[model samples]
Every structure is written in structure tokens, then in C-alpha cells.
Target: MSDNEWPRQLPAPDHGEWHDPPQARGRVLLAAGLVITVLLVAGGVAWQLMSNGSSQPVTQPSAAPVASATQPSVTPCPDPELTVAVAPEMEPVISQAAATLKPAGQRCSAIQVRAEEPGVTVDAEDQPDVWVPSSSAWLRIAADRKHVYQTSGATLGWSPIVLASPAALTAQYAKDGKTAWAGLIQAVTEDRVPVITMPDPLITTTGLLSVHGVHAATALTTKDPGIAQLRALTLRSRLTEAAADPSALIAQMSRQTDAVTASFQVGVFPVVEQQVTIYQKGGYRIPLIASVPVDGQIEADYPFAVRKGVKAGLAEQLRDAISKSAVTAAGFRTQPTAGGARLPDSAAEMLAPVKQWAQFQSLAFQVLLLIDNSGSMNEKIGAGTATKASLLRESGASAAELFNEQTTIGMWYFGAGSVSDPAHTEVVSIGPIAADVGGKSRREALAEKIGAYGPQASAGTPLYQSVLDGIAVMRPKVQAGRPAVVVVLTDGTDGGTRFAMSHQDFLKRLGAAQDPARPVPVIAVGYGPDANMNALQDMAKATGGQAIAARNPADLASAMAKAFLAARSAT
Candidate 1:
């Protein structure tokens, strides 16, 4: 029979219903038929007994010699443990679920999950036995639909991203009748509210959701000015660093003197529950209240999936647990409960959140442009009136525009002091440009600061000293994982510094400050007749950057733009 064929059930013969043959010659045939009927009856009875054994409370059957000889022993499988991998944002719910599962004698293990920024791609290629993404975007990016699909992953779980404020401030706003979501968004976007904190939208689901919620309420989807205003507010924010967990953000809020507003998950109940105690213990006198936005709502759904290539039994157990009641009580909706194969709830929730909070996707850059302010810079290099000052200004302007509001531009003027006089050597800090639009443009500001830099053709250049000063000033502000860049433009050799730190020293310091596994690139540009091309190349090579020789001011602009593109691409 083919494998698809169903097994046939045999019928038993009735007791005392045997028929005899008419003739003595047919007696042998009748006897043979009687024996065969008896055997079939016994076999049918045995099959029924075996089939009904587990459900019926009964004694074991007595072993018949022939049946016992034919029967084989069956070995049972050992109980399997259920494992789950969850995103870091949903740890509270996952932990609670794990606790409940443990007491029921159902073995459970949880893996911490973190989604890659901008896209919810898994940072690591290896799949967990069960993967739970904080956002649906993560599920789409991380999982292969054809191989292992989302059987069921969606639920109405609250991951509230509140606009946190001091209780006093919230009360004041409430009294003024201006505490709605619309009011808050307007106030924040218009700069009426000075101090506000938000997570990097690229990194945090809550941040992204909050932005989307606001956008939807305002109907400002196509408005460029509105978009730019929101972008500016997000960019000017001093805090974008993600805490290890939600609790850490709460701790930061509890310690603040100013009324700080930020987004956080509602499931982190401990943050709300312990607010008074934290405040009292910390001797904080201010009242902090958490309020949900009136016009918009956020419901984040986290899904647990078995990673590809996981062992079969463990994967099945995990799927079963995810589909079971225990997980639902902890706030996860199982596949069967979600009604479809796709994680729809999670997907819907992700859309609005990401759109509003897309500004966090902007790259973080550190650019140090070292300009050559020697006497030769006064001479024009191109048809567009490109002097050294003009070249430096042009390069700085291009960098500022290319980087736009994303990069921090710092300017340094070298060879300003007497080249021969070591004591007169000076390295002026012109502009450390941040996202502030009101601050002087990095290039124009630097030109104004070093307008008097010329005519003194000094005997030496304090090249190494200027590099050290630039590094020293910029190091403290450097954030980990951000691209740190130093762009040097010089037209002379190393000459004036009393203390000579070799190129190796510079490399060692720069490398030590950065993660050795992912070092920063430092580009160098040369201009003028006396420009030390070899030294610039050495500096760039040492830092994994490039050295470009731009003979004219226009060339300098192209070079800077190229460098800016490279920096953005790195992100």
C-alpha cells in the first residue's frame, strides 16, 4: 500500500455463529475457515485494547505467548525545554512569562534581543532558537518569509511613549488647558518648550512611535517646513544615547532638576510604581507625572520566533509555549489568537512610530578642518576668487552644507604665530559648530577669527603641536561608534614646536581613543607651493584616512565634499 493509504480496521466474528460444510469432503475446508476466523477475531480485539489503553483506566492485559513474541518495546521521548528570544524592550513581559512557566514544571529560557538601528535587522547573523523583535519592521528584515514565517505574532500590548514632565509643569499646563498631544507637539516643534528629551528614533521603537503619532495628529505629512522644524528639534537634542534598559532612562529622569520630557515604555511599571520612593530617596523636591498623549496612542507588539537551524524538538516546544495561555497572560498574543500567519498588530504599530521618528537616522559626524592661514593663502587659486581664506571658507561651507545639520564641524587655524618663534606658536579654536543654526557658520566664523593670519612667513610650523591641541579639545565630546574625522590643510613643513611628538605618538593617541576594532579616519588636504604632501600622506595613512592634494581652491571644495560623502557613507 502507498504511504497515503489509510489503515483498514478489521471486523470481529460473532460468538457461536460458525457454519459447517454440507459434505465430509468439505470438512477440511470448513475447519480451516473456522481457524482463520478465530485468528482474525483475536487480532481485532488486540488492536482495540492497544488503541484504548491510554485513555481507559484498566489493568494490563495478560500476555499471550504468540502476541508477546511478535510485540516490540516502544521507547518514549524525554520532555523538552522551551526557549525564547525577545527584544530588549520587551524584557519585562518576557521575564514575567518565564517566571510563570517555570513553576508549571515547563522548562523555559529567554534570550535578550536588540534590533539594529534604522532598520530592524538583527545585528548578528546567527538566529536565536526563538527570536522576538520589539518592532514588526525587525521581523520583516530579520526573518526569511519562505523558510520560517511568522505563524502568529501580534497583540494589543501597551508600550506607551509618554511626554514626561514634572508633575508641577504638567499640572500648570493642565490648569492652562493646554496639555493635549497637539499642544505638546506644537510647543516642542516651535521651540516654546526649551528642555525635552527623546530617544534616537533610529534606535528606540518608542521614540519612533511617538513621532509618528504626533505627525498623524497634526496632518503635516507633506509640509516641508513642518518636517524641517521637527528635524531641527530632534537634532538639537543633547541626549540620544540609549540606556541598557528602560529602567535606566527612568533613573535618569528621577535625578533631573529641570523638568525633562522623554519617551519610555509603559510596561516598565516599576518606573511608575517607585517614582515617589526614588524621588524621596534622592531628595528630589519636584513632582513628576507620567501622562499618555490624548490625541495619539501607542501599542507595541513583540513576537518570539525560533531562529533558523534550531534543533527540532526545542523549536516545537518554543512554538507551543508561544501559542499557549501562559505567554498571553504576560501580554504576548499567540499565533492562533492573532488569527493570521503574519504579525499584523506589530506591523501596524511600527508604521506610524517610524515615520515621525525618522530623524534619528541622521548620521553623527566629527569633522576637524585644519586650515592653512600662511601668507601664501592670500594669493588667488581659481577664477571664482579662491584665495587661501576663500578656499578654506569654501571647503568649510561645502562641508557644512554636505553634512547639513548632522555633523559637528570644528575649525583650527595653523601657522598663525611666528614660524621661527616657538614661544609665539598659537593654535586658535575658531568654531566647534553644533546643530545650532544661530551659531556662526563654521567656515565664515573661522575666516573672521583668522582674518589677520598673513605676511609673517615664520621660520617653522608647529604642525604636531596643533594636531595635539585639536585632538585634545575634540576628544571629550566624542561619542562611541560615531565617526571622528580630522581634516588637515597645510602649506609648510613641521618647524616650531619645542616638544616634538613623533607621528607614531599621534597614531597611538588617536587609536587608543577610538575602538581599535573600528578606528576613525583622518583626511588631510594640501594647498600652496610649500605644502608638505608627504607628511600629510603619512598622517592620513596612519589614521586609515586619505591625503588629497588640492592645488586650487575649487579642488579643495571638491575634496571636502568627497570626504563628507565618505563620512556619511560610513554611517
Candidate 2:
């Protein structure tokens, strides 16, 4: 909306007194000279803080333009006017500042901030003189979107990226007085789920940054970031709710545990300090868990970029004035603290892999986990004490429990010893809370069924034929919004079963039987070294799914994650 259309003044923003240093309490150091500066790196990653010291805050002059004592007193002309298309979340602060700004006897230009979504406004027909996105990450993205070779902007508000958790989980962080990014990742890996709310990164900068933030904090240099793979492995593991934007997600997921029922919602997400403060003042109960990583925090540096035809001087004045307002009135950090070093030029290169995470769907779907329980499946997996079937069961249980309840899931066990084998069964029917096994809900029942498979794993794997039948079970229930898929976990390729159809024949039938309108992806999980990764990949790819290989105990979790992640489009 335009400034002219907004209220002359917003009701003084009920915010209490702003803290000069904001809520400063933790530290996570960044490697190299990439000392976590407040800058937007390319590829849409919000590189918030630039500690390299190549320059000062965009609007902060060395000494606020000092006037000599002996200079003659002369009235200056009215300063130029500049329009700021401010991000929706920052509009109140910017507008409030505009109202309180003084003229000093000479109109030092009029500054106006109007709410705008950077993705939309940056390419609008009537462009604002200045663009203030919530994250600097959009500066380059906006420029590139416009097909323009270049666009320049400066950081106006520096709010560090922080991990905000519900108070219920705050105890985990209270001990060390620091946020543990690794701990969160490890918990997800172990199926100790952390409920987090996620926004679509394509639209929200925080959503985009959250994907990168979590991965960067958890990924080691020796390993792949696995951001997508992580999401795949732990589908809905960390998230309990999903929303259109970060704030809405937080507010939606933000709830105190029901003391009477002993039930609580799970969710924590990356939000700026300013947001946390605003929410608190607005009566949100969730508190900051730890605003840290240890090396450094990802600064949420709001950048003020000038579009074509905008006067540079006016843009500069606006950048300075808005930045100053963010600090003095809104509690944002606009400059580096004492002894802070500049971020290295190499930091941009490191941000390359983060782009993929932003495109993640994380949507819920209906799925059936088809486990191969042939006699060969009982073989040991690598040198590990557990057999392939045991590890599969563990991973399956973890994955099933971690998926959000919104997802409809079921399970099936298939063996190759002829189609009439007594062992083959539809353990969990395709439904929510599927026929409570042993008094446990579908999730629990499935877990128990998987965990109990020991000496019972006998007969040949009806891998191909079982999937063909499983698809029949899943296809009829497929709905428009809730995609369906069949995930086949096998330790070996299709063979040895008397009732098994030829691999080629199975593929043709699976292909021809598929209804494009009611797609059901058949994803494959090759559980052991004997499994055929090549054939599995092909079968999965045919149904718009993927085949993941668990070559050993170590790759089991990651492979499962990759397979689950591929399930999004499987149907």
C-alpha cells in the first residue's frame, strides 16, 4: 500500500522503550574472514552481517556531518523527498520514525515508507524511489529479476538471525546459555523431533534463510549440506505447523503445552530479534531460546536499494534516516560491535548450496511403506550388529513417528514365497490411525510391526509384484490435494520368487496401469549392498520418485531422508 493511503500516523505502535543493544547474550563464531557481516550474498541467501569493515553502515556518516563553529548561520533548502517501499513487517517502525523526524529549520527532505512485498514491488510499474526489503538477500535477486545488470543498496537495519523456541523447550538451552544448532539436527536424526513451523521460502525471506541457516549450522565441511536430504530424512520432523509467512507460522504454532492433557505443540523457527521483541510486546508467550551459533549470528540486515530513475542523493539520505530510526526507536543494530572483524569476500562462494532448500515443498501426503520381508532380507548389513531388516525397521519407525499427523500413512509386508504366502499382510490399512496395532495408533503400530521383524523374515522378496499390488491399494484412495505414493524398502533386486513377474513385464504393467490424473509414485529404498541401485533408480524415476541406497549403517538415515524427500512429487 502507498503511504498516502495509510493512516496519517499509526497509533504510536504500543512498543515499550527500545533497548539500545537489543537482546545481546550469545555468540557463535563464523569461520575465516567470513565473520558473518550484514550483507546479502547472491543466490538469495540472506548474508546479514559483513564484518570485513570495507565500509560503514549505509546511512551512518562518520560524524553525522559536523558543522564548523565559525560557520555563518544560513537556512538550508528543503531536502529531497524519497519514497521507501518498506517490507510489511518493518512498515510500522519506518512510519513511526517518519512522523517523529524533525526538520531542523530546513526541510531535510521528506521520507515516506509504504508496505510492499519485495518480490512484487521491485518489478512494479510504479517503482518506489527506495526499496527496503526485510533481508539484503533480495537485493541481487530483485535486480536479477528485473533483468538489470546491477542494483545498489545499503543495509538499513541489522537484526541478527536467532533461534526462537517455545518456552517449554528453553530448558535444553538454559544450561550452556548458548544455542546448539548441532543438538537440534542430531535430535531430528535420532527421531527426537523438534516441532518447527515453516513458511514458504519462495515468498518469505525468513523462510528462505531458515533453510540455509539450519543447514549451515549443522553441515560439516566434510559432508554435504543435505538440507533437502535432511528434510527428506525427517519429513515434517522439526515442523508441526506450516504457514504462508514466518510470523503467522510462529503465532499459529505458538502455544503453551496443555497442562491438563500433557500435550504440547512442537515448533521453533528463525526470526529476527526485532520480531521477537515485537511479538513479546504484542503478548506472544514464546521466548528466545538462544540467539546464537557460537561463531556469529546471521544478521538480518534490511537493505535499502534504489531502482532505476531514483536520485542517488535522496536514496542515501533515506537509507541513513531509516537505518537510524531502526536503531534509536525500533531496537535494531545498525553497526558492528567493538573488535568485530570484516566478513571475507569468500563468504559468497560458501552460500552456493543453500538455494535448493528454498524450493523444498514440505507438503503432507498419503503414503504406504512397503517392506520387503524375504528370507534374504535377514542378512547382516555390513559389519554392523544389526541386520538389514532391523536397521530398516529402525529407520522406518523413526520416519513414521516424525511425520506430522496431518499425513495419512499405512504399511505392508511382502514376501516372495508365492503370492499366497501366509506372511504377506496389509499390516496397517491405508488410513489415519490405521487399525490401532496392539493398542498403538497407526504410527506406533507400524513401528512395532517393523521392530518385531526378526526370525519372521522368510521366503523370497516379491519386490516388483508386491509394488504392483500395493499401487492398486493406494490408487483408489488418491485425492486431488493429497498425493499418494508407495515406498518400497528392499535389501535385494527382484528375483527368486516363483510368483514374481519378470522385471521388464512388471515395469510395463506398472507404467501402463498408472493413471496420470491419479499418480502414485513407487519410491524405492535399496537397503543393503546387494540391492540394485540402478534398477531401483529407474523404477522410482518412472513414477516421478527416486531410489535411495543405504549401503551401510551410516548411510541408512541419510538414504531414508533422501527417499522421503523425493516423496513430495512421487505421486
Best candidate per lDDT, number?
A: 2
Q: Would you list the C-alpha lDDT of every candidate in the order shown?
A: 0.46, 0.58
Which 10-residue window in model 1 sums to the lowest lDDT? 2-11
| Residue pairs with backbone atoms closer than 3 Å in model 1 (clashes) | 129-307, 130-305, 131-305, 152-335, 167-287, 208-353, 209-353, 419-458, 419-460, 420-459
Please, what are the lDDT tens digits per residue for candidate 1 over residues 342-442?
A: 22345445443353334333456766766655455666665656466655553343234333224566665565454244322333342344322346444
lDDT (10s digit) by residue, model 2, range 59-109? 654656678999899777454377778776677666655655546664454
Candidate 1 stretches greater than 4 Å from native: 1-80, 88-128, 140-237, 240-244, 251-301, 304-368, 371-486, 489-522, 525-539, 542-571
lDDT of 1 at 256: 43
Candidate 1 yields a Cα-based lDDT of: 0.46
Q: After superposition, how far is residue 470 of candidate 1 from its true place, in Å?
A: 9.4
The TM-score, computed over Cα atoms with residue i paired to residue i, of candidate 2 is 0.63
Q: Which 10-residue span in candidate 2 carries the lowest summed lDDT? A: 36-45
